[model samples]
Target: MNHISLYAQSLVYIVAGLNHFLNPRTYLAIMPPYIPAHQFMVTISGIAEIILGIGLLFRATQSVSAWGLIFLLIAIFPANVYMATSAKFIKFPAWLRWLRLPLQAVLIWWAYRYT
Candidate 1:
């Protein structure tokens, strides 16, 4: 993989991971109701993001991390869908909510590139 791509991906994940803690409520709000233990799941996913982000920085772990991120993206996709469908629950504009759907695909592709 290109150094720039790897660096960019690492940065995105790290920042996002940090945001999970810095703004846990934002994440908690978007979570679907069917998923139980919202707080616990949010924190666990945040920790996973941090560890995966750090792992991406190392050559030995890059592939594993990339795969992990792809899995993470897939795993959390329902939240994206929930955000798009349940627009009233989110504070963002309708356009932004709809955009998240495609953005999830982009993120998945981005992580797949690393693998």
Candidate 2:
């Protein structure tokens, strides 16, 4: 169970990191309207995610990486809330609509356990 959970967390971040490079424009599209220098901010976020994802792979860095991700998730949570509220623009299924909010909390909890 521990391995599965850690692997899942690692996979999520790794995929997110890849998406940062592959579909960077899509990531940029999700930035909140209130943020300035949107493209630059998106790019910076991508870099951070990628670095954290890589760091998570090492046993030595596992705890710190998990903690880092928790903070990162918290920092970007507003975007998730914004997307959830703007369903017209987002258009997710009802089940998945509010799912991420709680999922973030769970992920944070699980990540913290590594430390």
Candidate 3:
């Protein structure tokens, strides 16, 4: 079960990272107004996700990779807040938007398990 979950989480991060490059507009849209260089941030985040996800597969790097993921999730948290609160994202249901905030915590907890 541990191995299964580790692989699953790694895959999730890898695909999500890829999605940043494949659908950059979506990521850009949710970036907080205070953040600078939306495109660059998206690109860097994608690269980090890909690297960390791959690192999780190696026994030597698994714990460090999990720590990286925790920080990454924390770093992007403002975007989740922006999505929930901004009028620009009003098309999404209010409940769903708000749900993203707590979901980040869940993601952080999941990453911690690997650490």
Candidate 4:
């Protein structure tokens, strides 16, 4: 059961990382204007996700990978805030947008579980 959960977590990050490259505009759209180099940041995050996800596959690296994800999630939280608060993102339902804020906490906790 532990292994299954670990693998599932890994899959989630791997796919999410891939999505950054495959659909960068989605991430870019939500980025706060205050953040510089949207494209570079997205690419770096994607690569980090891929590397950390792979790291979780090994016992020696699982804890470290989990810590990295926790930090990554925290680092990108401003984008989530931007999506929720910016008038430009009004197309999304307000409730759903607001909900993403708490979802970040869930994701942080999820990563912490592996630590």
Q: For residue 53, what is the lDDT in candidate 3? A: 97
Error of 1 at 39 (Å): 0.5
Number of backbone collisions per candidate: 0, 0, 0, 0
Candidates ranked, most accurate by lDDT first: 3, 4, 1, 2
Ranking by TM-score: 3, 4, 1, 2
Q: Highest lDDT, which number?
A: 3
lDDT of 1 by residue, 1-115 (tens): 4888888889888889999999999999889999999999899889889889888989899889989999998889899889889855657888888898889889888888877
Q: Which stretches of model 1 miss by more than 4 angstroms?
A: none
Give each model's whole-structure lDDT. Answer: 0.88, 0.76, 0.95, 0.93
Off by over 4 Å in 3: none
In terms of lDDT, which candidate is stronger, 1 or 4? 4
- Model 3: per-residue Cα lDDT over 5-113, one tens digit each: 9999999999999999999999999989899999999999999999999999999999999999999999999999989999998889999999999999999999999
TM-score of 3: 0.98
Q: Write the per-residue lDDT of candidate 4 for residues 1-115, one digit (tens) a residue.
A: 9889889889999999999999999999988999999999999999999999998999899999999999999999999999999999888999999999999999889889889
Off by over 4 Å in 2: 87-90
**Clashing residue pairs found in predicted model 4:** none
Each prediction's TM-score against the native? 0.93, 0.83, 0.98, 0.96
In candidate 2, residue 47 scores what lDDT?
A: 73
Question: Where's the lowest-lDDT run of ten residues in candidate 4?
Answer: 2-11
